[model samples]
Target chain A: MTRAKKTWPALVALVALVLAACGGNGATETPETPETQAPETTAEPFVFGMILVGPQDDRGWSQAHFEGGKYVEEKMGAQMIVIDKVNPADRPDTSVEQVVDQMVEQGAQLIFATSDDMKDGILAAAKAYPDVPMIWSSGDSAWDIGKAYAGLPNLGNIMGQMEYGKMMAGCAAALKTETGSIGYLGPLINDETRRLTNSAYLGARYCYENYRGLNPDDLTFSVNWIGFWFNIPGVTLDPTQVTNDFFDGGADVVISGIDTTEALVRAGQRSAAGEKVWAVPYDYRGACAEAPEVCLGVPYFNWGPSYLEVARSVADGTFEATFQWVGPDWSDINNPDTSAIGFEFGEGLGDARADLEDFIAGLASGEIDLWVGPLNYQDGTPFLAAGEKATDLQIWYMPQLLEGMIGASSAE
Target chain B: MKRALRAVPAVWSVLAALVVSVGLLALAGAPPFEALVLVLDGAVGDGGRMADTLMSWVPLTLASAGLVVTFVAGLWNIGVEGQVIAGAIGATWAARTIPGDGLVVIPAALAVGVVAGAVWALAAGVLKTRGGVNEIFGGLGLGFVAQSVATYLIIGPWKRAGIASTSGTEPFREEVWLPTVGGTRLSPVAVLLAVAVIFLVWALLRGTRFGLRLKAVGANPASARLLGVPTEATVLRAFALGGGLAGLAGAVLATGIQHKLVPAIAGGRGFLAILVVLLAAYRIVWVAPIALFFAILSVGSAQLQLRLDLDSSIGGVLQGILVLFVILIGGWQALYRRGEP
Candidate 1:
């Protein structure tokens, strides 16, 4: 028995030594520099790695961010390392540490966590790896909107004004609705989606009160939280069915708050079947190009400029932590850089184009406050008192479903 | 004693395959060695980390130990995943509805969880014994159905009110949470409980007459039944015991790691438990160490990702490779003696 124990220790040592040697060989195999040496050009390739919450093929939330990563790689010749399909359900708390460490070891000077779920992990990693710059998408207001990032110095956030796009959708709906009724397809009843839907409603209300001269009672807004951003197989609210439910309730125009545009495709099918319905797409531009005839416009986010700015800061060594919020300048329809809401008037909206321009200009000037007071819940309880504008905090965390929304607060 | 000692080298040979798999991951631009170290550290290097590792071990041990019983009865209970999920749901439901004394609450929660898990497992048992369906497919199909049910509750009926987030049940109150070892998430009571469970199983498998009958039935069910052993009943009981243990494990996990029920509370621990049982060769004592090793791999993988700048999932890949290598090398050494004349 003693001899057997002795044999086992020797075997263990032998295995350990073999593993150590293999590890040593692995480090040596890592390439130091390329063989092709250009004498004059001095710009070293800066590696920037990204951790995505979903697969790039998700074609919605993750894919939009991936396109931004690719844009940086193509434009500035930045070496991009991307890790995808991270399970959000598990303890993703350590994922940031793992990604940051991996990326930094691979000579990445900057890392990006492209999901809201990655916020805490990214924040912790930001403090731990201060030398390596970190950026997160759709994070807390403290990170960007306030002076919180000033202390951190190495963290930054980039987000578009999604509310502007919703407004444009609402504007289009108000102009087109013969019944003066509109339906909104929302993924979750969170502050972000609520604010957007509210803005859409306000815009619709503004156009009806100012342009169409219809009573506020005639307009209806319906919301269904798909329970999640996307439908899990064999579970969750079906987005297509939800949209059909809204259309069945006599809603001519539907504004989507969900990630993917399958709802838009469903709307296109309805239009093809002679239902006379319209859809306003979110997240990406020219997505409505597939159904231009019934497509009202695209309320798109310009993540390109923001992405370039963030990457360039890393390259120039003058990057500071700040929340960068870029919105529409409202002058012309030509420049894609300035506008958060890309207004593409439908084939049927030839005469109404002038009216949309005026509304867009007014929104840019802040002449209309979307969350002004005198708002009532569907049960007629006052949400906002008369003449009371919602505070930024209240706007950021809008809890209750607004009046005229078609669906319940939660799925159940 | 000598034969037991000899198994160590064979085990290492199997583990060497795991090392090679890590190396392969390194080739894909990940740091396997560092990740491996992190996994080790995460499993047991310090008190806090050990506490976390032990916390992970509780559910794993419970399910794996139960699997040994099913294996002994010649039944593969693959539906432990679904059973665990069902158990969590039942436990969560009980925790919400059943108002009781503080002492009784936890025990009641565990009982509810175990019963739910057993019921899920027995569905497979009934299908196999009565409908003549294979336990493997029946268990797997039941597991899927259970997952859908959990998903339904999380996304639809059981979702927390006033929150517009994704599908998930309401979080458990602090009062309902199990007592932890000191302030850390690790429960001393859980460890003691698990030890008691192991002892009970060890006794059942080794010292009892039923144990011998189970072994005989597993070895040759037709012959055992011919010799007056009730094969179908033994198989069904084994499944119930297995499912009950797995359900208890699910309750522990829900009340421990997640602190709430979500659609993904099981997190594939049920399926991984199968590997744990196989690696231990269905030995209860061996499970304690092997499960710890797997947990360490998971923890160390993060460190490896940081240190080597490699993908963190290299640990999972290494785990698969380790199991594969162990089986291959163990088979080769068992069948064809290496370094022998």
Candidate 2:
């Protein structure tokens, strides 16, 4: 028995010794390749890495980013290596820095970390791999005044002017709502989401007053923040519940700000159950198709142009870190030809298309300013002085819901 | 001769698992040897990476060390994950509500966490003893409830302003933040506490009469009861003690690493602790080292995807294979013993 016990301890010791030796040997032998390489003037395909927090085909935020990646792949003939469903919640064992290291080791000269939550991870990796160009999506952390901003020479931030798209969606929702009630299905109440929701409310109010010939005061716009980008059951209120609650509370139009098709799907089901409900979906181009019968339209992001531009710059050795927030092309706001923010009207909209188009034209001509002075925050505090147009910085950090909206600006 | 013979099967099983993993890696279009090298390098390649591994190891060791006690008492504390979550929730509540600095806040939060976790586990124990429910089912159900409760709190009353996020509660006040060693994630005090708990558990199981009585109940409860042992009390005590340790791990996770109560704060480490206990063959002495090894594997294998273009799932696959091999070898030994007797 004594011999057996002694031998077991020795065997464990040997295993430990072997593991330590392997680890030590690996540290010495592994080459520390520079993450960034100078752009070569060859026709060789540039390998780039794209990291996504959710599945590529989630049909929401992640799907849009994946489509952007695909666009770069097709246009530039670049080799695309993607790692999807990389949520900190689901995979706590892995760090974003480690994933970036993996991408660097695989010879990716540039990487796109495409989630707001991935900002810290991407920043850490940017510092670790100083040569590799890192681009983060929907984040201003690389900007000069951003809260988490760092002056990393190799890091940049890019996001579309989605507020305008959201405004258009709000217009469509207002034109379709017979009850003068619009439900904004908001996903978390960050500055980004708050700004988008406020933009949508402004558009809805504008359309209701001008086209619908209704008192804007009578038009009710209520927002319910779901506390996350998507429903996590008991962790966050189910988007389905919020959607249904909106409809149950007499909202004829439910506008989704989340990353899923739940709003449209639920609206479609309610519509089929003999209710006259309308829905607007966000993110991907095909989101309206999830419930086309109830779909009003989609304000989708065309990430292709932005991603293509960044990749081409890197390939041409002209890449510089900048916070780029591209807006819609005025002449062709919904044009696949020019705009980063495109609005696709769904089949559910009956006879409101021409009016919607006129509204868009007015927006493009700058004849109707949504940021005009007379706006008060939800707390009844003046948000914009008379004749004052909101600056990009002001819009980016919008802190409260505007007047004429009913809902908590912050979660309870 | 018998010990040598037993070791052979375990060694063969492990080799078999490795060979299988290598084949799987090849199928995934990665060079197996290179991938292995990347994992090794990523895990302990430098001081920073080793610290990261240790950061993960501390909480895991604490939880698994607790599991060793539960497993020794023949209890499957599947609810340890829930206990961990409950602990975090309790700690987060205290951290948010209690007004103080790190010294005062940390201890108070951890104390609540221990009590909450113990109570949560004891509910499962009570169900088993009083309501004729299996601990596995009861514990699993309670775990789901605990998660739901956490989710509700995070998204509702406890949510951060201007952004109710799954990102978790807004970070605790800086003054209340656990002290770290040199800006690394490793909390020196947390590490010392974990080591202390491990030693305490080791002493409790190895040198105490209570430990012997618990073992007697676990070995043959009916016989132990007939011999005047208080089976129910011993079982309940084991559950509470195990739960308290798991809770402390949760508090450490919240106060040390996460700094906020994320929905995935436990990060499935509760279940991972079960695997650690099994790998150590339910021996308390082996739990810490084995937990450290698993932590290294998890932290290091994260690099495989970057280096070899392999999936991060490979880490999970490797852990699963090891557990499967160990269990198979154990089962084989048990069958051999039955045949010999």
Candidate 3:
């Protein structure tokens, strides 16, 4: 027994030494952070914090926001303090306040809480740090005239006018569909999603009548919400199954509004297998690269210009509490340095591409307006009087899907 | 001398884990000394950080304190996570549906949490004793079901107005939240809850005949039955008692920390408690300090990422290795003793 005890200590020392050597290797394999908060002697880079709700490379909304931060870094010699996957599902133990504390400790000057899901946490955090300028992207908490106004002086909102982008997606689906049926894969039931899906319906109805020279009444548009921005297996209805259901129901083109690209992948699979199908993915510009053959062009958010402007103002100490709902730079819609929204047409738009361009030109020139008069909501209530235009508030707080669409407007 | 001899393997286990940790820092190309300093500083660097560390300690200490009871009964209550979820659900129901305002709601909600957790665990206990199902498999299966139920409530019934997102239920009223220290997120009531639980568990295990009977059953259930111990009833009581403590931890998570019902509210702290108990060698006296050390690692991970530019998952890696080394040394000693006679 004494000999066994002696041998055990020797064996433990050997194993420990091997592990120590393994842990001591001089290699760094982690993804590169923009800049370290380590002390420096020269003029320090202007540091800012960004808390993202999903993975930074999710090829969707989070990726777009990440690229926007990278753009800010490029425009000004600034450093980014990025904390991704801050949602409850991913990092349940870590709260927004905890991450904000870390960011403040690292000497961040301005902070961006990018996601509608972070409304409560961002509000609490903004109040906690009264001097710091905090922007809650894709929220209406700072809109004084809005329904959910909190009136916090240091808190503000920044959101791209994704309404125009959705209109473009709807127009593309309308121009390309041969089955006269279109499917929309919505994320959830909210004012933001409701307005976007309603805008898509109006654009599709306008294009199917004028561009496609078809009876708009015969065109079918249906939307299905998957209860979240992305699939979480058992917790959510599988996006893959929903996309297939759309295609099997004879919808040749399906538009996606969620952060990820399930609709495009399934449509691509169906098209490759000799089915006439197409998809319009949302959020990221490079999402078409997933299945370009079946993509009907993507309507994406270009958050770079706004993020750059905010960074510059914050650096110059000229930042203020403002609700910035920026629109596309009509002069150059696809300009990375100018536009807040842009739609890049895919290769599958063989003959309808030119008509789609004409439709976009009409929208930019204000010759065609889809949000105009004589419209009814999904419940057949008068939405806008004849020849009347939609006010920003009216367009923003959209209560339901439009009359032509087939979907549950509100969860109730 | 005997006490010194008893501490030998623990000392060696900690030494091995420390050596491995330094090697890991070196592997990450980070200076080991500076990284260690950063983690230690970040964990308790200020009054606020100390509060955060203590807040993290609450759930872990309470869960492990409960684990001590189940372990003493020779029953692995893996369903602790499910019981926690059940407790949160029950607490949310009481907070939302209990009509009266803050004056009388908070304590009642916490009581509901304990009962919910106990009931959920007792059902699992019944499956083990009467239905011939192993607690491990039964507990695990029930855990999945509980998670699904939570997700359903968050997205379906308890979702925010006009929104079906799986973020969480609406935040509780400020008056209903656990009162915290001035200007900080630390709740003194939550800390007291954890301390009181540990004291109660230690007292119940050391000063009662029930504790003796539990030890007898744990050592040999067949022989314990012949000695006139009602084994099934004792097992059920252990399950209920263990689950009640887990339930309280869940209630603290909901009322004190989250202030709402979130799908992932348990935060995997239930699993972390299992590790803490294993590291303490199932000793009731050792649970608190070991849990505090783990809490420091958890709260300091954000700092590790910021200062050393290392991934925060390294903290989890360190935790797993520490437990692995302790168990290895413990099992080796057990094998040596068996060989002696």
**Cα lDDT, all candidates:** 0.69, 0.79, 0.81
Candidate 3, residue A77: the lDDT equals 69
Summarize candidate 2's per-residue lDDT along A1-412 as a digit string, tens digits: 3433443444344334323322311221212222322234477788889898765666788889878888887777786777665764546666677667667766888999998767556876898788999899898877887665788889999999998888889999999999989999988778889889999999998898889998989999999988778765446679999999999999999999998889999999999999999999999889988889889989998888888899999988999888989888888766653678888888888799888888888888988779888789999999988888888888888888898799877766
Predicted structure with the largest TM-score when compared to the true one = 3
Q: How would you class the docking of model 3? A: acceptable
lDDT of 1 by residue, A274-341 (tens): 98888776766656765777777767665655777788988998887776655655675325544433
lDDT of 1 at B206: 96
Instruction: Give me candidate 1's TM-score against the actual structure.
Output: 0.68
For model 3, the DockQ equals 0.34
Among these predicted structures, which one has the highest DockQ?
3
Ordered from best to worst TM-score, the candidate numbers read 3, 2, 1
Q: Could you give the fnat of all candidates in order?
A: 0.25, 0.43, 0.33
DockQ of each: 0.17, 0.27, 0.34
Q: Which ten residues in a row have the lowest lDDT in candidate 2 chain B?
A: B305-314
User: Candidates 1 and 3: which is better by DockQ?
Assistant: 3
Candidate 3 chain B lowest-lDDT run of ten: B2-11
Spell out the clash pairs found in candidate 3: A23-B23, A23-B24, A24-B23
Residue-level lDDT for A412 in candidate 1: 50
What is the interface RMSD, in angstroms, for predicted model 3? 7.7
